[model samples]
Target: MWHIWTLDDWEKNIDLERSGHRCGLRLRFDKEVDSEVRRACKEFAVFLRREYFFPIRVVIYVKARERIIAMDGDKCCGIFWCMPDDYTIEPYIRLAAGDYEKLCKKWGKDSALTNILLCMAHELTHYFQWINSIKLTPIGKERQATNYADYVLEDYAETREHP
Candidate 1:
């Protein structure tokens, strides 16, 4: 069972009052997740939203399972679901913590938390592209998202190192 998250549920609502994007972030996590995973995601979501404005309000659902079938029926780390024509419908990003851990091990990521940030960054990039009406072939979009994710992670690393 899922419910709207609150300040008592691990992370406080991100203070986007001055962001000027009229955006908000809502998060829901399955009961199976540990606090560590939730914390990493919440923190990274804040960083993403602050650095790259959300085109609209967004919800992020972190699933417990290791894998999920995308609309195309392919297993993936995460997905950004949106209908380009209907901005009124709140878009959401779905990520699986188990899959993040597995991918971290498989791809030699620094850690699962880092993998989580990278995957979410990828999905968020897709969200931006969708809202901005950027058209690309499927492969091209994937490449762009991948590049954006890398850039985000690198930028995040810089912030941590300097601050």
Candidate 2:
């Protein structure tokens, strides 16, 4: 969970002690992750707190990059049905980079940064669902997250300059 914020990880929490707009969400990643993905993680947390009222900790790591773009590793709370204290967001950083390269070739206009931002946004959408009480079928879940990502990307792009 978010308590995985070791002393090293807790370094980011310094911002939490600041005056205004400090996010409760904590994002941690391994050295294997690149700078771009790291920046995206920070920005995504800010977006959630500001736009959607979700101030949750999200740990991003690179233990796996083969099977999926990203997966939320927060298992069900053992005693109850709620999510645990922190959210484990295992973003397949290398895989996202690969997807960005391939998608860039096919799309011809989007940048590597935007493509990966989309991936991160998609995973965060799942996070939003996990914290809420709504339930959906497998296909329904995918559609909701995809739609949430698409709408947020388009709207946020139009409204502000995203990193």
Candidate 3:
């Protein structure tokens, strides 16, 4: 199972108040997976909260999926589920173990890490859009999420390169 942590866990274990007024829940990966991906996810979470002004708790689940490989072939990279609340919606993100391994093998660890961050950002954007009352069809919503992720990743890269 993936390393699962909830908001309550973060609240009790982590310094929530110091976490930039936003709380994050992190899921740890197994030792076999590259640790850099985990670090990037956390960093991206902070970036999302600090830059986007979205107070969010990022829950990282590492190796939590029942199937390590992608059932739907290699086309599907990962999955993200969002539950919208009145104030905020929780996002659940997962990457297929097979996909992760395949990407790492093909693109190296750094590229795989970047991909995960992009996917997470995309999923989170969808939740935010829903909360903000953006009317969209299912496909449209997915497209919007992808677009948001692309935009954020581009922005993040530019900022990092210059700063």
Task: Give one digit per residue, the lDDT tens place, for model 2 in 1-163.
Answer: 3111111332342234452333344554555555555666567557655765443444433222323422364331110112333333321122234243444467643355566556556666665555443368868867876777677777567755654
Question: In candidate 1, what are the lDDT values of residues 1-163, reduced to their tens digit?
Answer: 4211111221122233543435666689998875777877777767766765554688888898786679999898899998766655678999877765566568654566777777877887777666666679999989988888887888787766321
- Residues 1-163, model 3: lDDT tens digits: 3111111222332243564445444565766555566567667666765665333554545553323334445344455555544334455556544356667789887687677777666656654564355668989878877877787788787756321
TM-score, one value per model: 0.76, 0.54, 0.62
For model 1, where is the 10-residue window of minimal lDDT?
Answer: 2-11
Residue pairs with colliding backbones in model 3 are 2-64, 23-57, 24-57, 24-58, 25-58, 25-59, 26-60, 27-60
**Which one wins by TM-score: 1 or 3?**
1
User: Candidates' lDDT values, in order?
Assistant: 0.70, 0.47, 0.56
lDDT of 3: 0.56
Residue-pair clashes per candidate: 0, 1, 8
Alpha-carbon RMSD of each model: 9.6, 10.3, 9.2
- Provide the clash count, candidate 2: 1
